[model samples]
Target: MTIYQKVQAVNHLFNQLDKDLGSFQQSTGLGCVANCGLCCLKPDINATALEFLPLAYHLLLNGETEQWLEQLQNNTEDKLCPVLNKVIAPGSKGFCSDYAHRGLICRLFGFSAMLHKNNTPTLVTCKPIKEQKPEAVAKANAHIASKDNYPLISNYYMQLRSIDESLGEELFPIRIAIEKAIYAVLAYYAYRELPSKDDIV
Candidate 1:
């Protein structure tokens, strides 16, 4: 598939995963706190270039890719996500500027499951949820152990790798992933004919 086709396919998968995660949250009564962007503040969050293809493509179409690319290239001090919109005051919760096109790690971090050594699924969650809602966390873990519908971290990641073995499987710091994704899209379009807008249909 072309780069655009791969992006559309991955995005379609992401949309379905989002729906599944929403349903899981509803069933378990576990969710991210309102306006809580603590997860986005993590400095070590890792992602793959392929996961950000849609975001990169969107920026490219909007004529913002080069500016953001420059930012990524030059940004060396801040470990927080470049897309995160932080408050002026220090230690405040922030928001993702590009929520709709966020990467897979962003989508799955708070509401997904990981596989145990014995092959059972374990609900992987955040500290705030565990501390503030211990009962809910326990119940969600039980539900995950018994249910087959919750999104699995390994499963979705494998699905991502299937889209493009090289780019999708290589993990990097989230910012670098974003930069690589932008570079991939830019390089692809630089050498090939740009698709007509309707070609996306």
Candidate 2:
């Protein structure tokens, strides 16, 4: 699929998520706290190449693609997200450097829901919410039980897979995922600029 088409897909999914989260908040009166970056600080969150495509596009548009790739390569062993700002003003949350094109895992980590084995839905949320808002938790759980929530990762991924199986199907470590996504975007433009050649796949 073309890069533009990929971007369109992410936008559509994000809109759907916005609607779903709005409804959920109206019903449950719950949300992730402002300035909480615990999940973002986690060392092991993973993502797919497709999830980072938008970030890649943004990097290219701003002419920072190669620079960011070099940054990632130089920091391969560091678990911190490229977008995270470790040093910030006191009481300020470290922010995503590329919030607009953040990966699916980035988007999904704090606010989304997942399906449970007993045919129920569960909020896949971060720790702060669990501690700070016990009552909201009860209400949100009720909302989840109603089952009219946003499309889960599995569903969105299925749709993405239909567009390009490789993107939808391949999973990688968080660093690797980011690397692949960057390379995917770069290679895409490079390929677009090249003459068409037959590959004996």
Candidate 3:
């Protein structure tokens, strides 16, 4: 499949995950704090190249791919995601510059689950939710324990790997993943025609 095709597939999965996350949030009344960018501030976040294909494609269309690559390469700090808006304060008012084109890991972070040793799902959330909405967190965990169709991180990742084993299988730091994705898109179009917005759909 072509790079455009891969982006479409990854995006389809992301759309579904968004729906699931909405339902989970609605059901449990658990959510991130308003304007909270704590999660985005984390230095250890990891993602795959395939997940950032949409973002890469977006940058390509905007004629900003090379510019972004240069900026990413120049930034030595691996602590914060480069996609975040630099004008905003780091901890409280952070926001992704490309919110719509954010990767799968960005979409799944606050509202998904991971499997534990005994094969039960644990709601993977941050400290704010645990501290602020303790009861709701408990209810979400119980909902997962009941096995009633909450989103599972492993399942989504497995689906991602199936989309394109090579690009989807490995994890890199957020900026590295974004860089790899930009390169992948650029290389794919180097010897071929760049698709228009309508062509991609």
Candidate 4:
């Protein structure tokens, strides 16, 4: 399939995930924990090259691709994610400046579910939830007991890997992934410019 097709497939999966999350949220009433940027601060958040392409696409569309790439490269520090906006208040409600282009890691972590090797469902959440809503935790445990479902990071990567043997398989630290994502966007547009809707395929 073409790049646009691939992007569309990824987006479709996101839509399915959204429906699932909506149900999960309504059932549990356990929203994202407060002031939670722990995942953001995580030293190692993994993302695939395929997962990053859309982000690059977004940067290209915004006409910020080259400049953003240069800025990311110039910042020798490997720890900070280039797209991470610290000023946006360190909470779950805070969002990435470029939400549309967020990598798989960005899209999956907080809202998604995961499966255990033993085939159990596990929620992708942070410490605050475990602390603030013990009852929610209990309900989640009961939810798991139902063996309903969860977003398994590994499970998703399997499909991603199937798309491009090299792509969805590997994960990079969030910063490097963001850096590469930015570069990819710039490179795509620099070489051929944005495709008209009819030319997207």
Task: Give one digit per residue, the lDDT tens place, for model 3 in 7-48.
Answer: 889889989899999999889987887777789988999999
> What is candidate 1's CA lDDT for residue 110?
76
Clashing pairs in 1: none
- Give TM-scores for every candidate, taking all chains together and pairing residue i with residue i: 0.91, 0.85, 0.93, 0.81
lDDT agreement of model 4 with the native = 0.65
lDDT (tens digit, per residue) of candidate 2 on 33-142: 77777777887877777777667666676677789889888987888777776656675544676566677777666456777797566777767898898788877777
Query: If the candidates were sorted by their TM-score against the true structure, best first, what order would they fall in?
Result: 3, 1, 2, 4
For each candidate, the alpha-carbon lDDT, in order, equals 0.86, 0.70, 0.87, 0.65
The per-prediction CA RMSD against the true structure, in angstroms, equals 3.0, 5.5, 2.4, 3.3
Clashes of 4: 5
Please state the error at residue 3 of candidate 3 in Å.
Answer: 1.0
Candidate with top TM-score is 3
The true-versus-predicted C-alpha distance at residue 184 of model 2, in Å, is 1.1
Candidate 4 structure quality by residue, lDDT tens digits, 12-130: 66666667667766677667665566677666777777777666655555566678767867876757666676666655346466666566677667555676677667777777777
Model 2 residue 170 lDDT?
86
Weakest 10 consecutive residues of candidate 3 by summed lDDT: 85-94
Question: Candidate 1: where is the Cα deviation over 4 Å?
Answer: 88-94, 195-201
Highest lDDT scorer: 3
Give the alpha carbon lDDT tens digit for every residue of 114-149 in model 1: 988888888888988888888878878888878757
